[model samples]
Target chain A: MKIGIMSFAHLHAEAYIQNLRAIPDVELLGIADDDAARGEHFAQAFNARYFDSYAALLSAKPDAVLVCCENSKHRALVEMAADARVNVLCEKPLATTLTDARAIIEACERARVKLMTAFPMRFSTPLVEVKARLDANEFGRVYAFNATNQGEAPLQQRAWFVNKDLAGGGAVMDHTVHLADVLRWYLQSEVVEVYAQTNRILYAKEIQDTRVETGGLLMLTFANGVFATIDCSWSKPPYYPTWGGLTFEMIGERGVVLVDAFKQNLTLYRHDLKRAAWNSWASDANQAMVEDFVAAIRDDRPPRVTGYDGLRALEITLAAYESAERGEPVRL
Target chain B: MRVGIVGAGSMGVVHAASWQQTPATLAGFFAESSHDATRLAEKYNARVYKNYAALLNDVDVVDICAPTHLHHDFVLQAAAARKHIICEKPLARTMAQGRAMLDACRNANVKLLVAHVVRFFPQYALAKQNVANGSIGTPAVVRLARESARPKRPPNNWFFDFEKSGGMLLDLMIHDFDYARWLAGEVETVFAQSIATENPDAPLDFGLAILKHKNGALSHITGAWAFPPPNFRTAIEIAGDAGLIEWKSADTAPLEFFLHERAGDFPDVGLPSSPLREDPYTTQLQEFYDALLNDTPTRVTAEDGLAALQIALAAIESARLGKPISLAEARA
Candidate 1:
């Protein structure tokens, strides 16, 4: 299977490039970016071809492509890929607006190309195991979820995360999508209402220009009468060992399960780094998500994480922002 | 000073043990249900008071460990008797009850300390002190969680009643609510979601709350009565602009605080303890004694207890109404 990557804007692209190369039969054909220097730098560093433009990459006619541009810039690149009849796996928060999200989904459906959202948590090993138990009636009925998706401010890796026009919003847009997607998948329910609170006190001075929220707490009510909270904040400080992690407690009538999706690690107190560091030894969810994307294309089926899933999660995100602004619960 | 311990249940014994070590003498025990009242009174070399009024009259201070519905009467009577007070957490079952108790204490000119013992836990205590001392810079975001097995209550135990104990939100998570306010000023609003409390037959209860502090900080709190026996855990993570502090009650973490264990012999009675051999409960009550003796302020004031109750009650209301309750509206 051959695939190309569009843009090097999202830092996840670097890891995705590594994952593609790790697959036995997968070919990372090239990387394309409007930022020529960035495109060329990653292409050379990872030993792949460099395409100067999205049109050029699409014209190359790889079987599929991954979009890793800014959150708002996803639409144009994805549409162009679909127009070229290329299956696409778009980075999370699939688009900044509901209109854009809808348009992106419609573009893929119109062109008869597969569209998957890059939600790796759906493939998380620990989450998958508990989900299997949840399906087998081992827990009877799930009652509520207490979850968190926290990380350091991404200014060092990708500065665009703090830019409102490019990123859509702050922590709510950046971190809410992953767990929102996971909860909807595990519970197989639609969120009916959202109430959220956010604060900018943590990183206002660090980010300098944007007053976008650095800390956010979101409460979601599902159609199944299940409710959950998402601490979707980029509030990790500089000394944190790793980027951060995703964790949740799922409560059921019979039992409860607590999951830390990223807890498999070896901790070392290293003198060189002058801090305790965590070296992860866990299975990579990004790799699993990509493999699933590849299998869906081979089997000619929709991916496990579809564009509709992305749209639904984005709906919740938008509703959360409205809820926070209006100081009330916003119904979906 | 003489400290009369009320209610001879698990917490009653726990308090009796702690007060024995304090400078104050243990006055006696009083309980309608004498599961361990007689043994405990003997163990402390104290007599058993036949009634609440007799206990109040005999002791200079009253430490009430009764169920939620009994707290209002116990504290009011204790205050009326001109005794200093140390009441078990939740302070009262409802906002109005809490307010009335605070008012009574003020009118009687008596000192009342709510046993929010989490404040005295070394980890949390240090976290609050560090945040105040600029160790983590200005507090930006806080995550707190406390989950313990459903107490093996008698069939009619008020812990399971939403009106009497407020389920897990008022009885369990209120500890974190008070701690959150202590770490990051007063809260401005509360938004929450809960599960299973509405279903009387459900085996477990869970609650998640988001507190927006007046200082522009956000705190995400999770509390549950869902684990099986002997399975309980708590976690805390506070992120500020300069640094972050995180701890969890697990084998791998530095802290080994095993609170509220229904220990051997008294399979249904609690002996909340820390591996550090430090009893936060004792520390809490000792400070209460200091406040009464020195005529100074204690760590948890009656107003602080009232403020925490306001947040918990607001959380319960928000969970039921599916809306965010501003502190102004919650106050009203």
Candidate 2:
């Protein structure tokens, strides 16, 4: 399968290229970027072609196009790919608005093309094992969970990431979709309502900076009676030195299961830190997600993270934005 | 190597037991001028000091396990008498007092170590090892929580006085704060919120602090002395670019050490039953003694204690003023 990339702009674009290159079943098709310089850089680095325009890449009609564009651009890219009858693996936050998201889904359906939201977190081995354990009542009755999403303040890196119009919302929109989607996937339930608050206490940028807060706190109630919270932010200072990953605690009726997907440790203890290391799921989460996305393309299968799932998570992010803006809970 | 413990409370007992079987001598015990010194003296097989001056002048190393309010005076006196010192945490109520204690020890050329025992905990030590070995990559996010159910009857009434112990931030949360600072580094800024319920008539027992280091790693710490039962739960999750590492005291059952790393295959990193004894206090005392005897450095230095205390105080000040507090602001 020749998997060409649509943008080098999305943060995970490099990972997409590297993973695609690593898989034997896939070939690296030329990449397209709005900026010719970036496209040329990737082309030279990866030994692929460079296109200055999205239309030119579509005309080449690669087997699949990885839509690594911003949320606002997802809709147009998906529509263009569907019209070209090209399959798509869209980066998360499927769309900026519900209308555009719904339209993309309809276009993909009408064109009979495979459309997948690249939510590779679902493919994480530890998370999948956690899901299995939760399903088998390994940890017991599901109670509450605490999830955190922290990264470098985006505003410190680029001005557009903090711009509400270009990026959607700040940290909440940027991060919660992934966490929310993972929560939904793990719980196998819908998010019924959300009460969230956001502010720009860290990044002093003025553009759609609603999402570029020093920190964000959220309370979510899933339909399956599982309660979860997401403390999201780009508030980590430079000196502390860390990257982004997921660490969470799940309380059940039988026992509590603490799983860190990024860390790939699923430890079950009798009750304290002094015990032995339990069975830990050690598969590479990101690689697993990427492999699944590629397999879906090759086998005519739907992705582990469907476009609908991404839309739902995107809805929650948007709802959180509305709630923060209106100072009220936004019901899903 | 005779050791004189200046408090006969629970921690004092822990300390006394740690020193008794070791090479160090259990010189005697002392109580606040008001407490029942004679009763405690009888239980511990030691003499009672009616006068702290007599105790300070008598013992080779004066361990200040006294309440926070008494820490400053006792340490100063021990230093004046040229006694080696190991004082309990929050070295003093205020940074100024802490500095004074440091100055006194320096002037007297006495070996002074502060008991930041968390670093010596086998589990945290292992967690530190993983981070140092690039197991988690460069840690981007650190979420640490230390929560305990409020004591049914807090020992000293002075614990409620803000001027005495520096409130919960110093008295209880300082453990997590110190550990976070040690694991992370110098915190450049802090934004915090706290609650002191009038019904309890106590200092702030529950709160959250967001700390930023100069290196860009963000730390979220939620500490409470107001849980429902006598539970000591502490968990740390560090997310790095390559992987994740976490520790939860409660997840390691039957044992007291809780350290978990992302492993492809299980490696037996089991901890031996206490290094010198089952008590960490003994290990601490042994380390201090070895450092002095061998002309090495103490594991938990006075400077480490001071940095931890400074971060704790910064969190408190942030909570007090309802804003993000900076270390620069703290120094000013």
Best by lDDT: 1
DockQ, per-model, please? 0.74, 0.03
Q: Give the TM-score of candidate 1.
A: 0.94
Candidate 2: segments with Cα more than 4 A from true spot: A1-70, A74-146, A149-173, A177-332, B33-36, B154-156, B198-204, B255-277
Pairs in steric clash, model 1: none
Q: On a 0 to 100 scale, what is the lDDT of residue B286 in model 2? A: 82
- Tens digit per residue, CA lDDT, model 1, B1-332: 98888888778888888887789999899997765788898788898988888888888989999988889999888888888888998888877788889889999998788888889888889888898899889888899988876677677877777778888888888989999999998999888888664455566778888888988889999887777666567888898888888887764355554577655423452223456664887787788888889987777888888888889989888888777788986566
- TM-scores for candidates 1 onward, in order: 0.94, 0.58
Q: Model 2 over residues B1-332: C-alpha lDDT tens digits?
A: 77888887656777887787578778888887436556666766777887888888678888888888789999988888988898988788889989899999999999778988777777777888887887766655677877664444445556677888777778777887787777777888776655555444331256667676776666777666654343467778765544556666666556564456455322111112333435666777788777766758866789888888888888788667645567876777
Cα displacement (Å) at residue B62, model 1: 2.2
Query: For model 2 chain A, where is the 10-residue window of minimal lDDT?
Result: A235-244
Superposition error at A76 for model 2 (Å): 5.3
Q: At residue B48, give the lDDT of candidate 1.
A: 91
Worst 10 residues of 1 chain B by lDDT: B264-273
Which number leads on TM-score? 1
